[model samples]
Target: MADKSNAESIITETQKRISNAFDVFDHESNKTVDVREIGTIIRSLGCFPSEAELHDIIAELEDEEPTGFVRYEKFLPTMTKILLERKFRPITEDLLLQAFEVLDQQKKGHLEPEELTKYLTQEGEPFTQEEIDEMLSAAVDPDKNVILYKDFVSMMTFDDTR
Candidate 1:
């Protein structure tokens, strides 16, 4: 029963995250976004990757269909499985601090919206203005454009139980 509940929780979380990604993609472009966009979207959700790294994601999607525009249904399980498998670097407190280091362009101890956007793009993870704003609102300090170490840590740490 516990295992079933855990699976259900993971599925629900995956659905929420993927839904957010779809909204982010739609916000990024008025027209249809392709499967290649998945890498960028996932990265924007705070994953980092180089050009080569992103290509792997695109390649995986391409294997499913040539057009590369991964519909929401396709993206959810792919990403969820990736998360469950611990494929990418683990989301740890240390990693969260590193993300701030990457995002804090001004070195001002905080991350402004522009800085975060640039950082995300630099990491090859493109984000919509709305998505950037949302992430900032959730975790960043509006006054300083930086998130506190604790807040950043909290954002990345998963309870697994919840």
Candidate 2:
């Protein structure tokens, strides 16, 4: 089944990344780590779990003892599920480009910094000025005439490990 295949693939890839991350915390390679390090291990794998999720994980591990070692194997299944359920996955270039296209009134492939800033901060979940500044710094063309949106979107969505 297609649904089953998707789950299997996601589990397989997440397992590999999680294993790499767990190995870093399991310094002794014992496949076990302190419950305190659970949050660090999840973040190291690039999954941005919320404080509530992190607390839940720590609590789950603390069930047998207030603070104790957690078998990495016990976490592989749980981590894969968390990864699948995470909402803040990386954005795609196509979606970004489509948004830009709507803003490009004149059908220009680029946008002025001011125009881009207004839409970014005034619409949707308004981005902070600092976040806009950081994004624009690498996104703007050298001449500073306009933002090549295609290039900008690509830079934002890039993930080497993918």
Candidate 3:
């Protein structure tokens, strides 16, 4: 049987792999990541945790503030749940790369609402035009079609009703 130290080491190594997977999906090239981006990353990994799954994970994550935004300290365990829920089995780096290519539709290193909606709909989880409009409203300036990385990250990080 594995010793306690060995088990801890294994856990650390698994977390490392999960973190690397997240790095691949952090399209803004920023260290700070967001949950919608996380959802895309999870889908890329061949898993689709429902909204309920994400809510439960977020609820359990330490450092959730009264306002409900997770602090950087809580981000790792929260992301770990998305990246390594099915055990420490190795996830392919190629898959991560492919997922990035898919998500980076504009090749701008940030996600646009239209891009996200199209991708989700392609996967059979459609987002209505109104939902797309609302999501875009959060990130885009009125009459603007482009989304800055900072705004995009903020929108992706925050949980929304739509």
Ranking by lDDT: 2, 1, 3
Candidate 2 or 1, higher lDDT: 2
How well is each residue in 10-76 modelled by candidate 3, as lDDT tens digits?
6787577656766776667665556556555545444556667756665665343544333444666
Reference-based TM-score of each model: 0.47, 0.55, 0.39
| Clashing residue pairs, backbone N/CA/C < 3 A, model 3 | none
Model 2 Cα lDDT, one tens digit per residue, 1-162: 999999888778878988888888896789888877887787766665566767887776554666487787778877877776764354566877898899999998999999989998888778888879987888789886689998888776646253
Better of 1 and 3 by lDDT: 1
- The candidate scoring highest on lDDT is 2
Would you give me the overall lDDT of model 3?
A: 0.57
- Tens digit of lDDT per residue, candidate 1, span 63-92? 454764655555667777766665554366
Q: What are the lDDT scores of the predictions, listed in order? A: 0.65, 0.78, 0.57
List the candidate 2 regions with Cα displacement exceeding 4 Å. 1-13, 19-78, 84-89, 159-162
